[model samples]
Target: MVLPGKGYRFHATGLTHDERGYPDMNVKTQDLLVRRLVDKIRLNADKIILVDERWMEDAKVVVISYGITSRVAVHAVELAREKGIQVGSLRLISLWPFPEKRISQLAGKVKSFLVPEINYGQICLEVERCAGGKCATISLPHMGGDVHTPEDILAKIMEAVK
Candidate 1:
């Protein structure tokens, strides 16, 4: 689900809804279903949660971004690298069932994580939780009229390294 910038508009025609029957809401049945779903997600997490890590070797700081924001982050990471910042780029291709294990591992290795998102700090919260106070998690939030400039992300990356 791509959350576009504010004032971004599109027209969808001939959209059809698949009407699945109402979920079984009996307490016992619901509990069982929920447990099964959680198990399924856990079992497939390695396959479902996609993350792209770049320049991570010996990185002191990592930039974590998703959706459209990840695109901007790539340029910012490249610029940071050109300036010789020991920063890595971690683009989250799948947000749900988040890559907490990777974040936790990196937290122990890196000084901080910079999460720049078009929204006001959703994924950053998860990053912070996963870091578990092992390292700093900086939220570079944008209010969503448009995507953040690479310079903005680069500035945060610079801050994170410090």
Candidate 2:
């Protein structure tokens, strides 16, 4: 069940549907929406929100990144590791619900979070919102024409770990 998303680097061709206004939410539509919400949460949440969490145990900082920007984040992570930084990275395979619980838990244990995104901190807003000042939080945001260099992200990781 691969969902359509903006993975522009991979050259995905799926359209992102845009709908607004729930004024027509009558009984049938409302029930269907409710059932879908429950089924996604109660039945298949773990399955839906794919995460790579191997580095959680010892990481001092966690990088939350996904989509096209995730590949760049990997380079940053490797560089940080080379410099002997206990930096971890989490690629958000699902964007919704924002991984609040995991972020909060990591905040309790780690020093901070680094979120690098192609846009001007759109997703970072959600991260800071969920972080709730638990630990240090920062975002490496760009205007979306070019990706962040590993050096750029490394600098932020270095700053955050400090």
Candidate 3:
């Protein structure tokens, strides 16, 4: 998460607070800060939004994953490839300020996206939104306590190709 620089301070209601400040309660101030942050993210997107894409040129299915699940997705992608499936992998290194443009571009090319996440489905929702109905977004959701097995993701990948 991003944090304000040291010695930075916050002001609210025309009163400056200490270094450890309270939330900015002013709507106008909040809006300005949010807009600035978004602009920064857009201006430096290439540096801020990091992703690792592999074997996408002729892929019918792209597996989108991140964090620990990304590690698992790697093995799954290898397994699918061994079976001669036209599958690819996209590992998200920066979750926030999502790589929407890349996802949207890929959505137009691929038949579907398989999102294997440890949650009930968070990032998968973002993938679905960015895909914009151009392609299917499948969520292989695991409700915590354990990560998805390679076979589980490979199964979904096979289903997606079909």
Candidate 4:
């Protein structure tokens, strides 16, 4: 399970605080803890990463989204397919220790990717990283609230295909 973060929420909350919200962890301890947690996830990535993809072998573009945004991504993918665009979909079932290899393999098939998400380009960064300049990657980020409209994603797909 993943808990989406926010600028305000992360700022307002912290585990380092005591009952009265005072510092309970020193800078060194906090840094070490966070570093180790991140290292653990990356070290055991194969056991953690999960992705569910619906892609066409000849697809020129893929629309990838996660969480609620994935719902709209499917709609947009269908709309693009209806328009004769070889579009496909990929849903990020797991957020951390991202499915980098899966995305990289897809980059060999698809010409580009359009990733829409509620947050500001979080997963899109991973896509770009794994893509390794093999193909284009686009981000249709929303600050928060609602998901992307089919038209919005379709428009981006159209742009990517072109």
Candidate 5:
């Protein structure tokens, strides 16, 4: 089937790479496409800040997240607040480029940022970069595809506060 946003064409048949046990070239193409899609998502998100709030004029901790991951992050922030932690959240819908300026602004007010993501700390690196050394940053990472529990993230938030 033809894919949207890309061109498709027919070419003369070549050797049967997969039939001989060699990896299918299509698989590589698919990987490239996935990578491109991810890049696009990140680029689009560069300017958008999905969530923004400041609990105090000089809060010490801020949380940043994206997509389904963001839901759990919100929960964690709420729980942290209830427990008297001066934590705030900035949920990012876009992830590739990251929200650098917003993070820099947060760094001015907070001492640390708690980054939670489904992957094994990929986005956490970006958070650290955006933090610009104005604050310390750490991650609450989940390697699984599923979302992390609020208690899990809240626990990290608790740690960052200390």
Candidate 6:
């Protein structure tokens, strides 16, 4: 779900209906909104450390995931850590504001960032922007309703680092 700005509560279950009523035929505006939120969260999240995007150079790799997809990503991170891969994950509790600066910092330190999502491909763009060509970015996208497994995320992370 490509949402504009954070702190706004909008629900999106599937693609058939753009339930949030995104601005019509205005892709640029939509992209701008997404960026704005990303910045906002990055700046404001120091309190909870939820939206915080600080870099951990020793982490080696970072994984970005949300919703159900994120659940799997969380498991994957755990698995990777157990295997001594030195992985960490940022699970977006807030969707709109993507925490760009924090992500940018993370991008600089981590060797790679993996974005696992259910859509064809969207958030990958923002991940790239924040990465600023410093770190490689990879996407593990799933179109069907079948939930991705921890193994799925692990595979993508492995592929990204390799």
Best by TM-score: 1
lDDT of 3: 0.88
TM-score, prediction 3: 0.82
TM-score-wise, the better of 1 and 2 is 1
Per-residue lDDT tens digits for candidate 3, residues 1-162, read 234565545433334322244455566766776676589988888788899998887899999999999999988998899889999999999998899999999999999999999988999999999999999999999987988999999989988999
lDDT of each: 0.87, 0.77, 0.88, 0.82, 0.75, 0.74
Off by over 4 Å in 2: 1-43
lDDT of 5 by residue, 1-162 (tens): 355456544232243233333445687655765676677776667444355554645467888878788888888888888888888888776554556777878787788988888887888888888788989988888888578999899889888989
Ranking by lDDT: 3, 1, 4, 2, 5, 6
Quick one: best lDDT, which candidate? Answer: 3
Off by over 4 Å in 4: 1-40
Residue 114 in candidate 2, Cα distance off native in Å = 0.7
User: Number of clashes in model 3?
Assistant: 0
Candidate 4 global TM-score: 0.72
N/CA/C clash count, model 2: 0
lDDT tens digits by residue: candidate 1, 1-162: 335565545433232212222344466666666676689999889889999999999799999999999999999999999999999999999988899999999999999999999888898999999999999999999999889999999998887887
Clashes of each: 0, 0, 0, 0, 2, 3
Clashing pairs in 6: 37-97, 38-98, 53-102
lDDT (C-alpha) at residue 48 in model 3:
86
Query: Residue 16's C-alpha lDDT in candidate 6?
Result: 30
Stretches of candidate 5 off by over 4 Å are 1-58
> Relative to the unseen true structure, what is the C-alpha lDDT of residue 133 in candidate 5, on a scale of 0 to 100?
90
Pick by TM-score: 1 or 4, better one: 1
Candidate 5 or 4, higher TM-score: 4
Report the C-alpha displacement of residue 13, candidate 3, in angstroms. Answer: 14
